[model samples]
Target: MKVTLRTDVLTNNNKAADFNRELFESTKTLVVNIMSSPGAGKTTLLEETVRALAKKYRIAVIEGDLATERDADRIRAMGARAVQINTHGGCHLDARMIAATLGELDLDEIDLLFIENVGNLVCPSGYDLGQHHKVAVLSVPEGNDKIPKYPQMFMRTELVLLNKIDLLPYLDFSVEEARKDLSEINPESTLFPLSARTQEGLHEWFSWIEGAYVRCVRQ
Candidate 1:
């Protein structure tokens, strides 16, 4: 019975995900679902991303958190459209929650839509929000062992943004070890080490987004 309940929940979520995927594809909007453990700089990274890409793309963000509207507010201050989804004790934002928020934004007018999943390394990974890509953020402070410790999150995501690289010298983190572990777990996945604060290696991330956007539209 427990297994049955879990299956039913995901099955329903997948249906909603399909609905979202169709809507996103029809509008040619590039949707990226970014997930990470709390304080992995997901919001900071997004703030920087919006500031950098706003002129080139019509960017918007859907900020998911367990309670506060702080992250959404931060994105809006960057001059991008943002909507906050308070999960209210929910560890992850499911597909239906996203489908419900679509009406709040004019998807056709937006070229890039980023869904910042509720800060978590585990629960957010199992659910699909119909995003074109799923990227994970692992900070330098979080240490190198996280990739292997939380293999599910690393295994499922196509790209891993190694955030807070500015602290690399001060911290004991090893970027090489991270790349090695990720390769072992998910060879197809790419690890991008960057600092949202200093903008180091961030252009590579921006370039990747531009490429993703081009592919999203061409399809």
Candidate 2:
């Protein structure tokens, strides 16, 4: 019965995901779902992205959290449209949650939509929120073992943002080993190292978003 219930849930979620994908495609909105463990710097990275790219793109964010409108507030302060989804005790954001929130924003006016998934390396990776891309954030304090320890999260994502690299000198995290492990689990995935605090190596991240936007519109 447990298995049956789980299957039904996923089946329903997939239907909603299809519905969302159609809506996004019709509006030409490039949605990127960002996932990470708590304190992986997902929000900070997003704050920087908005600060730098808001002028060039019609950006909006869907912030998911177990509780709190704090993240959404931060994004809005950065001069972009943002809506917060509080899941109460839920561990992850599903397609239906996102689908339900879509009416709050004008998708046709948004060129790039970022869904910041509830911070969990495990559950967030399992649910499909109908995003064009899935990105994982791994901070320097989390160490290199995270890539191997949380295989599912790294395996499912196309890009891994290695945040907090500014602390590398103080910490013992190995960037090379992280790249190697991620390659083993996801051969096609790329690891991008950057510090959201200092904005080092952020241009590449912005460039990637620009490229994704171009590709999304052409399709």
| TM-score: model 2 vs. ground truth | 0.96
- Residues 132-189, candidate 2: write the lDDT tens digits: 9999999999888888899998889999999999999999999999999999999999
Candidate 2 lDDT for residue 173: 94
In candidate 1, how many clashes are counted? Answer: 0
Please provide the root mean square deviation of candidate 1 (C-alpha atoms, Å): 2.2
Candidate 1 per-residue lDDT over residues 1-219, each given as its tens digit: 344444565898999999999999999999999999999999999999999999999999999998988999999999999999999999999999999999999999999999999999999999989999999999999888899999999999999999999998898999999999999999999989999999999999999999999999999
Global local distance difference test of model 1: 0.96
Each candidate structure's count of clashing pairs: 0, 0
Which residue pairs in candidate 2 collide?
none
Cα shift from native, residue 41, model 2 (Å): 0.7
Work out the TM-score per prediction. 0.96, 0.96
